[model samples]
Target chain A: MSQWLTLFQKELLEMWRNFKWIWVPITFILLGVQEPLSSHFMPQIINSLGGLPDGAVIKIPPPSAQEVLIKGLSQYTSIGVLIIVLTTMGLLSGERKSGVAAMILVKPVSYESYVTSKWVGAMLLMWGSFLIGYLATWYYTGILFKWVPISDFFASYFYYGLWLTLALTVTISLSAMFLTSGMAGFLSLAIVILMNVVTSSLSNWMEWSPAQITTYANKLLLTGKIPDSLFPSSLLALVCTIIFLLVGIFVFKRKELASS
Target chain B: MITINWGLLAPIIIIQLILLVVALIDLVKIEKTNGPKWLWAIIIIVVNIIGPVLYFVIGRRNH
Candidate 1:
């Protein structure tokens, strides 16, 4: 128990001392502020453009408060996903690159504890950034539209955050198993894009493909209807999470850290 | 995005399984080399689901 705490503390301190905390929160906050702000102002900006000299008249329809909120949340998802991927790309790979892993292994810490602590620390940072971004977006959207359901706003963000965090955690675990930090980050991004593309391409044939979990969660938050498709994807994501985490630990335990 | 299409899911699973099998074969062939076989195996098996990008980037033999 003491070792675990010490590991956690060391990991946390390394993360903070590295200034990751500052950059992550800054990035999330920027995403949060941009989402609702853009949704609220885009229409007005377009309208203010007036008619073109070529006789092109763009009729900009006013978006409802709900529409704006949903748009903002979706934008948040895009930016948040990118930030999570980049931030966690080297969570473990970086240590290996910097020769930190060899030194750490020489200490009293077990491989399980070391890897698990890194995982937990990464999760904490990811979740904390996500929550801050979600809350900021939710609050700003409510303020701008004056029609958001305040009671359900937090709940919706929580659900979305869980799915996003799980997806990111799996990505990080896979990244840790790879050799290069750049490869880890690139692979993580590719996996996300591939999931979306394959799922959409097969949407007509395969009603559910783990990718639907995000869409379903978004729908539930935006429309309040939980689709049956979400349940299966949710289960799949959970299973994948467990599998990836275990594999990561197994690989790390047997890894020759001195080589890196 | 939450829709059901078993047909789509089937191909995904099959593709991933095939990749996993190919990666395992590659792992066996390269196990005795000086390179890091486990790292290559993981990259090929796990990251190859997104294609062979990671494998090409970090898994292939350095020679």
Candidate 2:
């Protein structure tokens, strides 16, 4: 237990030393803040462009506060997915690429402990950042609209964020297991986008496909209408996440680190 | 304050069991390498469903 804690602390400290917080939090906050701010102000901005000489007849309807909040949340959701994928892609792969794994292997830590600690630390940090961003957006959106229910709004955002985090973690684990550092990071992004595209394409045929999980969760949160189909999709995602992480760890433990 | 879905949980458990079986097969086949097969096996088994990822990231040989 002490060893696990020590490893966790070491990994987290290393992450902090690398200044990941700066880029990650900045990007998250920017997305969070932009979502509400833009949604609140877009109508005015559109009206300002109404002075077109050619008379484009741009009748910009004022978005309701709920519409604004939802728009902001959707924007945040997309950006959040990107940030999680990029940050996690190199969690393990980077250590191997920099020869840090060799040094760590020489320590008293077992391979399992070391890898588990890193995974836990990364998940905590990633999930923590996401929660922070969600809260920030929720608070600001509530302040802007003054009519949005904070509890319901936050509940919906939280579930959506949770699902996104789980999906990205699986992608990261797969990337780390299969590719080198540069390739791992790129492949993580590719895999995520590909999953989205493939699942969406199959959504017509597969009634309970993973592609609709995020959308369904968001709808449930927003409207308080949980579809029976989402239960299966979410279950599938959870199962896939566990499988991917296990496969990654299994492959990593026996990999030829001498060449890595 | 989220509602738990047992029906959703069922499929996840099934998927995990399937993954575990697949991982065990891989571990058995790869036991003859330079490293301690038992240690690798334990790592894969103990890490539960995530063990395979660690194996892939740091365990397997290129050849």
Candidate 3:
């Protein structure tokens, strides 16, 4: 317990030093702010700068505030997810490569403490950045788009956050097991992208899978509609997160910590 | 430029500048990088959001 706190504090200090504590949330806020403004003004953007021969009528109805927020969320899933994954991909592997992990592990730390500390630190950055981004988007939605009910916004935010948590779990596991940072990132990203694509294609069997929780969040935010699968979705994701995290601990416990 | 709304645009610019400044500071402070350091400095300034992101993820190996 105490060991975990020590390592977690070290991880936090590492995050502060690396400037992730600043840039990542700023990036998220940037993306969050950018999404709604662009979506809201797209028609104006086209009129002012969209090159057309003298007269070309293109009808674009202003999207509903809900739709605008949803658009922002879709942005989060794509570029935002990619950014989140890539920035933190090196958490464990980089430590190993730089010999930081070996030094820490040498000091009577449990493998569980090492991995859990990484997980906690990554969560702090990921959740902190994401919530700030989402709140900014929500505030902007209220101003520039429409005032969505706070309940719907919070509900969808929790659901979407869990989905990202699942992604983070996979990333933590991959970073612990893999030696090379790039490979860990590539494989984790491939898994996330694949989950969305494959789960969509295999729609029936995977509908209740955590892969669809993101879609659920979007829908709930856009229309305040709750899918019946919400509980099953949460349950499956929680189970998977715990299982994968435990597996990562198990793997790291046995494997010689990163050699390079 | 007359049509531009500076009020609306200011927040975006501020956030981006924050990212840019932090990235530049880190690039200068770090002792070494995965690639040439000068290229990273240029990329951080020119490329907008993606520039600093890539530099942090790839340029300096995390300590």
The most accurate candidate by TM-score is 3
DockQ score, prediction 1: 0.02
Give the better candidate number (1 or 3) by lDDT: 3
Alpha-carbon RMSD to native, per candidate? 15.0, 16.8, 1.6
Query: Candidates sorted by lDDT, descending order?
Result: 3, 1, 2
Could you tell me how far off, in angstroms, the CA of residue B31 lies in candidate 2 after the best superposition?
43
Give per-residue CA lDDT, model 3, range B1-63, as digits (tens): 226677778887888888999899889889999889999999999998889988987787745
Query: What is every candidate's C-alpha DockQ against the true complex, given to 2 decimals?
Result: 0.02, 0.02, 0.60
Write one digit per residue (lDDT tens) for candidate 2, span B40-59.
77877788544644454345
TM-score, prediction 1? 0.73
What is the Å distance of residue A239 in model 2 from its true position? Answer: 1.2
Name model 2 segments beyond 4 Å from true. Answer: A47-50, A53-57, B1-63
Residue A161 accuracy (lDDT) in model 3: 81
Q: Whose DockQ is greatest here?
A: 3
Top-scoring candidate (lDDT): 3
TM-score for chain B considered on its own, for each of the candidates: 0.58, 0.69, 0.87
